[model samples]
Target: MRIAVAQMCSGISPIDNARVLQNYIGDAAAQKAEILFTPEMTGLVDRDRARAMAHIYPESEDPVLAAACAAAKHAQIWVALGSLAIQPIESGSEKSVNRSFLINPVGDIVARYDKIHLFDVDLDSGESWRESSAYQGGTQAVTARFGETVLGLSVCYDLRFPALYAGLTNAGAEILAIPAAFTVPTGKAHWEILLRARAIEAGVFVVAAAQCGAHEDGRKTYGHSLIVDPWGQVLLDMDTEIGVAVCDINLQEVAKTRRRIPAIANRRTFALPKDFG
Candidate 1:
């Protein structure tokens, strides 16, 4: 299978983001890609909470979601829209949810996954974020079926949790999508390392479309959209560029890697030590 990853510097305008996504869809289709993956917060990236609140809408009403659907339909390609900020169905903890959607070739939503792990950190760079204050975390993990292959869905911060990948792989996921809008400091230090590790351990292909460059919201993102094979081989890396990359997805590699390592099957569940502290 052939796929495309779009590395973007998403602005604060949903409409503008929609237009950018449309162009990426066209570009990926032109390159004969079957599916296109985009970065997290593909629609809006604003630090001003009050300003961003006005654009937050349900999945049905989100302009970016609607536009992406239309673009996918016109292009006749599937789209693994990395993630979108949408209003949750029922949540009192926060007003919105970080969600990922899988749109089929016909532009119908086939699966949805909300980001279970929220990013709440205070960096030494003096950057702080209380993501939960703006969006609520999801409780369930999700995977999708695409062209006879299984796909695991996850978001930016979820990459840090390896157990999630283990569960996904055990559930028959051959590929994992970890779309992100990572901060510069975290991105430089751990982005590639973590992605490669996940691919190596799970023996699954890891595709990460990332947001890069400075944004209109007075923040910068580390942008190195990466695609790694099951054996931890780097196939494609879009570095610090706002563009799209099309590559082939070799499922055979996944099988070969798993057969070689068999880590997933060899995992043993042991009870934790009691009263260690």
Candidate 2:
């Protein structure tokens, strides 16, 4: 399947971001891509908590989601809308949900996965974030089928959790998607290693589209969108650019890699330690 990974520097306006994404969607369709993958917070990426909250809307009313689905149906291509910052169902709530969606060719939402892990950390670069302060975490892990491939869905912070990827791999996921808007320090130090490790350990293809460059808010994001195969080989990597990177992938490599290593089947169950001195 041919997939397009889009790296964008989104700002406060959902309308403007949707317009930018429509251009990418049109480009992907022109390139004959079967699917397009966008980065996290594709709808909006403002650091100002109040302004972000002010513009927050539910999935039913989000203009970005509507535009994406409309474009997908028109292009006759599938789209992985990396994520959107959407308001909770309850009115007057302070926190919103960081949600990702899978839109089929018919412009229908086939699957939705809220980000389960919130990024709350202090970095050596003097960068700190408390994502949980503004967003609620999800309780479920989601996997869906697209055409002949089984897709595992995850967001930025979820990439650090190995157990989550293991669960998805065991649940019949052949392709794993991690859409992120990662900080510069962490992205430089741990991004590629973590992604390649996940693919190597799980024996599944890994596709990660990321936010690049600086946003209207003073915040900056590291952009190195990557696509790795089941054999732990990097198929394509965009080095900090705001553009579309397209590549063709074959699912047969997944089965071949799993059969050669067979680590998933060879896993040994062990009892947890109960007593400690």
Candidate 3:
């Protein structure tokens, strides 16, 4: 199946982001892509916690999600609306859920996965992110079927956790989707290597659409979107550009790579080593 990953610089307006996403969806459909994947925070990208929270809405009222679903149905293509900043349904809630949705061709939302790992760190470059302060983390690992492949859903910071990927692969995921809005520092240092490692370890394809360039909030992000095969070969690398990267993937490669390496089948459990006094 042909898949397209879209990279964009999102601002504070969900409406504007939705319009940009619609164009990408159209482009993907024109290329006969069965699925279109987008980066995290596709609805809006803002560093100011208060301002972003004030602007966000629950899934039911989000114009971005509504627009994306309409575009998906119109294009007759499936969509992975990477991740959205969603307000809580309950009144008086202090934080929101960073959520990802899988929309079918007819616009029905088939699956949803909230971000499990919140990025809460104080960087050495005087930059810091307290994502948990504004968002609630997810508890479950989710996998869904997309045409000829089974997809594991994760977002941004979740990519750093390999055990999550292992669980997804064990749950029958042949492809892993890691949509991100990565900071420039970490993206440059660890993005490609971590993605390749996950692909090699799980024997699954890794498709990571990303957010890039400078945002209106005065924050910069790394924008190299990538698609890696099960053999740890990078099929597409969209280096720091706002565009669509498309690749035709064969599901049989997942089987072929696994059969050769047998990494998943070569598991052995052991106890932790005793510490020397």
Q: Evaluated with TM-score, which candidate comes out highest?
A: 1
Spell out the clash pairs found in candidate 1: none
lDDT of 1 by residue, 1-277 (tens): 8989999999999999999999999999999998999999999989999999999998778999999999999999999999888987556444699899999988899999999998888988797889989888888889899889899999999999999999999999999999999989889999999999999998999999999999999889999999999999999999997889999977999889989999988998999889956
Tens digits of lDDT, candidate 3, 1-277? 8999999999998889989999999999999999999999999999888788777898899999999999999999999989999876764676899999999999989999999999888978797778888888989999998776799999989999998998999889998999999889889999999999999997899999999999999989999999999999999999987978799999899999999999888866779999999
lDDT of 2 by residue, 1-277 (tens): 8999999999999999999998898889899999999999998999999888877898889999999999999888899999999887864666899999999998999999999999888878696889889988988999998998899999989999988988898899999999999889879999999999999996889999999898999789999999999988999999888988899999999889999999789876799989988
Q: Tell me the TM-score of each prediction against the true structure.
A: 0.97, 0.96, 0.96
Q: Which residue pairs in model 3 clash with each other?
A: none
lDDT score for candidate 3 against the true structure: 0.92
TM-score of 1: 0.97
RMSD of each: 1.2, 1.5, 1.5
- lDDT of all predictions, in order shown? 0.93, 0.92, 0.92
* Order of the predicted models by lDDT, top scorer first: 1, 3, 2
Candidate 3 weakest lDDT stretch, 10 residues: 86-95
Error of 1 at 71 (Å): 0.8
Error of 3 at 26 (Å): 1.0
